[model samples]
Target: MQLVVARIGRAHGIKGEVTVEVRTDEPELRLGPGAVLATDPASTGPLTIATGRVHSGKLLLRFEGCLDRTAAEALRNTLLIADVDPEDLPEESDEYYDHQLMDLDVVLADGTEIGRITEISHLASQDLFIVERPDGTELMIPFVEQIVTEIDLEEQRAVINPPPGLIDDSQAEVASERDDA
Candidate 1:
């Protein structure tokens, strides 16, 4: 299993140090020195981390053989990938990798089938699940604890307790339904 650990940003200085936007939770473990990572273009790497540090709250990494600003700048926008075990769980028990949640059936707390998770979108602030319904329609649901109540890997299902107007088209309709009941 290959996971994106970081994305190379612009060159920091005249040295080979380049800024990196850390993607993985365990940056020290994933992007530390001596770690070799693959690249997105597949030709730019595998980049071996010669040195790394935190500067101005951003990760700075210098790859072996990249000795100058020109060499570091050439790696801008390149994704750093780490090879991990398929069964490797995150350090945090509550967290999950994107692959773990993919293909899981999505259901309401009442067991109403909504769809199956087709993709997990990692956004800036939060993640979203792209669910495809039985009819081929799809919906994007925020993968927050308040909405996604439970994830049963063995059951291969995710139980959602979406707020009003989330699964439904209109919040008014959902409110009215509650009133009628």
Candidate 2:
């Protein structure tokens, strides 16, 4: 299994270091020096991490052979992928890998079948579950504790307690009207 560890941002300096937006929880293990990562473009890398450091709360990394600003700039926005065992679980009990949640059936508290989780979007604030409905439409549900009440891994399902207007279009109009008032 290949998991995204980081995405290369702008070139940090002339020394080939580039700022990285980390995607993994274990950056030290996944993005540390000596780790070779596959690239999204599949041409820019297989980049080997020569050095890594945290500057101003951001991760900066220098890859082997990318020894100049121009070389580093060419890697901007490239996703760093690391190979891992498909069955690898996150260290934390409450956390889950994207692969674990994918394709799980999503249901409501009252056993109403909503959809299936097709994708997981990792945002700055929180993760979003992209649930695909039976009709082929999609719903972006925030993967927060308040809305997502349960994750039954053994049952292969997620129970959500979405607030008003989240899934129902009529409820959304009511919510909009209330906000205007």
Candidate 3:
């Protein structure tokens, strides 16, 4: 499987270094020196990492053969994809890849089916599972330990303990009105 590891940001300096918005939890392994990554735009790369560093709390990378700012900036907004094996599990038991979580059945602890996971939205604060309900309506459920109580990969299901207003439409509207007031 091919997974997106990062997205190239603006050029860092006059050098060939460019900033990257990391999408993966394991940047060190995927964005390390000598790592060859496939780019989204077929023409741009298969880029090889020459060097990587942390500058001002941002990850900066220099790709092999990208010798100047012009070369680096040209890669802006390009996605970095890494080849991954489907059978390869994360080192930590609690860790899961986005692919692994995709399409899993979402349900309440009482076994009431809610929906199927359609996508995962990765935000700075937390990841959200975008679920498609039976009627084709979509709702975002925060992928947190308190809410997503369990993930049973074998059974292909996620058990959640939703808080008030999270899944209840009427409760959500009431909460919204309360905020407006």
lDDT (CA) for every model shown? Answer: 0.91, 0.93, 0.95
Best-to-worst lDDT order: 3, 2, 1
1 or 2: which has the higher TM-score? 2
lDDT of 3 by residue, 1-181 (tens): 9999999999988989999999998899999999999999968999999999999999999999999999999999999999999898898999899989999999999999999999999998999999999999998999999999999999999999997798877888888898899
Itemize residue pairs with steric clashes in candidate 3. none
Candidate 2 local distance difference test against the native: 0.93
Write one digit per residue (lDDT tens) for candidate 1, span 1-181: 8988889999999999999988776888999899999999899999999999988888899999999999999999999999989888987889998778889999998999999999887788999999999999998999999999999999999999988877767976978899899
lDDT (0-100) at residue 77 of candidate 3? 97
Per-residue error at 145 for model 2, in Å?
1.8
The C-alpha TM-scores of every prediction are: 0.85, 0.88, 0.90
Q: Residue 145: error of model 3 in Å?
A: 1.8
Worst 10 residues of 2 by lDDT: 84-93
